[model samples]
Target: MKKITWLLLLVLLTATIHLPAQRKADRKTLENLQAHITYLASDKLEGRRTGSPGEELAAGYIAGQMKQAGLAPKGDNGYLQTFTVWEGRETGEASQLTINDASFAAGEQFVPLPFSAEKPAKGDVLPAVKEPDNIWLIDVQDMELNPHAPATDKYLEKAKEAAENHASGVIFFNGKEDIGAVRQWLREKPAPLSIPAVWVNRDVSRKLDGDNASGFRISMQVAFQQGKRTGTNVIGYIDNGAPNTIILGAHYDHLGYGEDHNSLAKGEKAIHNGADDNASGTAALLELGRMLKNGRFKNNNFILAAFSGEELGLFGSKYFTAHAPVDLERVNFMINMDMVGRLDAAKGLQVGGIGTSPSWTPLLRESAEDMQMHFDSSGVGPSDHTSFYRQQIPVLFLFTGTHADYHKPTDDADKINYDGELSVIKLVYRLIEKANKQDKLMFLPTKETQVSSARFTVTLGIMPDYTYSKGGVRVDGISDGKPAQKAGLAAGDVIMQLGKQPVSNLETYMQALAAFKKGDKTTVTVQRGTQQQTFNIQF
Candidate 1:
């Protein structure tokens, strides 16, 4: 009885005493993460929009934080690695419209379309047709172009027909009441389109004779310029007396003031605080950096990089990989954190790039212990990790998952699940520790999985699971009220055939979707387990 009591006491002591130390460390880490997110996602930062003053503020704050945390400045400049991007926008004065004899004011009576060229254009206005040699005009006063669904069926059809027929450009006739919406929409598309395009109000439209529309000469001058905006990537290098380098990165940029085209909300403009989108990831990176500063590692020096311009494109990461502060060849592995704020502990965290190295799967599994996790074998994903992965370096991407507030103005700091995110960060920290102790991770090229960033004329509104390495595209998510959802397409449905085309991969799927137009009826075949089901989709 005495021996049994002693054994029970020892077991209880191990559970109570030994684990509290880890818990205390984790609590401090969580606090650090929260502090970072609070500042980065704050409204004063104005959504951390790339190229904006807000983004510069964020970069400055990050650098200061890193300095305070005792991180060695690894950036070309002191805690700042600068890169330039071709940022262009419509200059208010140069963007003007003159239809017939009436001159229209910019951003009011008339505004250039998102796809319009910056150069001056004067051409005869004609009705849209199969092949329009002159500028095509489309009147959308009677059509329903909702704020959410701005690209109506008729609008898309017209655009597609014009593009297909090799039309020079298009002019849309929107009423004066919709000027604000039009401006909001145009602001989203910062770059020029295939051909020059413009939008004029009905007041200007009234000036044109319906019978002799070809008689009207529309003169438009939309000016845009490419200038360099300087931003920094806050980098910290930890010297562990090891020759091998391991990089950990996260993009700190977000869509500022819903000005960028990526924002989902329309009409009313607000600051798109990208808390979960990336501030979360940036926070995780900071916390990891702080821990690693004092943590023990047998081998591998660490590079903690907080990148900018990820919202613009993968510009920051791409530049970093190209102009690597450290040798790229010696990089043992890379870990990227993006959108890790809203972790659902039950559904488990997702770890991508498992197939980037042969040892990744086993290493992740061994380090994860009983933590709930979904392992994805793809190296290519929409994050900073892909940049390193492309350079033949092993990578692991941590994502908490997408939410309704993704890329929207409503994605604020208050929505972050701190405890859940802390759990995810802890898991990643453990994995990194394990990786550093092991032999240099061998980089393995994963099978080419086509990621669908394709622009399509029509879509069934299904989010394809790019990580699924299968013969057919798997429908991981069905967008609500979309054609696929209305057609009885559910999540987990593996799309085998779209129309008559065999949907072999994401590329083929895009081709099939592009072949369709709105209101066109097509049969979609999906393999749900052993059964093949056919459903009709009206796009």
Candidate 2:
């Protein structure tokens, strides 16, 4: 009897010892994950723009981490999912335009828009004439005028009709306005038309009128060539023998060159350290990938995808979904991390896309309940998940909200809330584990794109918040087919007003946009440049 008691005691003690060691291992795994995040989000990587050396270095580092975690490379020949992209200015070759004997150089005076799909323009210049004759004119009064006004189908129909009637050239007059906005407008893909088009700045317009060069024969040639530059998407996976997979993705690219505000200042223009713009999210994915691999969760196969060209309008994600390595039908869900390192503990974290999947709310709720963490949830908004949502995959997007240091040079590692981020990762780990164990997730769609139950309501066509700005919502890109785009909103156009209400930031904009209905027609005011203009859009 004494020997039997001793055996039972030994078994209990052994079990007790193993339990604490398992807990210790979990904690250690989380710590190592955080350490990885600190390094990736560091300024050393220089923002990891896709196709750049910094981005390559970052990708190599992630592949190494995956290897170390025992996750196999599911990408082409080990780590890269290579593809091609267009490089250089929008115009392919040297382009020149002569107006009334005055010549304008390509890039300096004008260049092709990024969206144009036509061959480069190269031919002899033609004479200019007034309307009712053989010429059509688009008068750009000032920065306040909406250049998209003429790009609409209605305007294109009119322009096409005029072209068929034998119009010579469409001359755009600045009418005392700065040429920057006009230049941006003209740079967009031109609608298919036979008539040639040209734009003149206020100063140039003055020269044309003063010199009486309007009717002078203009002869010029515009040559263009589209270069084929290669790009890549880094992908890694951990298999658990399940047909369904959970994907954690983030764009690993930022605006290259000195174009966007995030670009480094003149002399320092070589690298735009997108620490918060995306290195934060990319770093978070790296850390999470490592944690999941080490923890050895057996719920489902996991896919870690670091996309390229997000700054170029979610191009990477779009490409990945269109040409997926794995079956899209087997992707159970996606949890996307964009800017998770800048959490404000006091305000907690804001999560979107909760309504996209019915299982998300309950799973997140239970995980938070057990972990005792604070977080807020929204049904839907904008992010890469929109890509998968269109494919019928449920998604959840994690964000730390926006701040003043968002896209600026100030969004460095020091500003990151490491402790808050640690909590978020823990919550994510738990959520992933729970999701893997569930039979399947339920699909839920937001009745309205904008959730009206939030503290404030504003409507801005569910554009993804991309600017790394500190406070107010900084939109990186607008949705292609959302209400905002239908209203003529572009990627860089900042929302200053919604309907009659003034929206100083994203919160206010959301509140205002939510007040309207799907079919509601409202006037929206946006700041395109130095001026604000209103447009009537039917929602």
Q: What is the C-alpha lDDT of each candidate?
A: 0.77, 0.62
* TM-score leader: 1
- What are the runs in model 1 whose C-alpha is more than 4 Å off? 1-20, 87-224, 227-230, 452-513, 516-539
TM-score, cand. 1: 0.68
Write model 1 residue lDDT over 180-241, tens digit each, in one string: 55654443333345666676777777665266565667777776433346666888888887
Tens digits of per-residue lDDT, candidate 2, 327-413, equal: 988888888887777777667777777767667767988788534434334334545666676566788788888877655556666
| Each prediction's TM-score versus the true structure | 0.68, 0.63
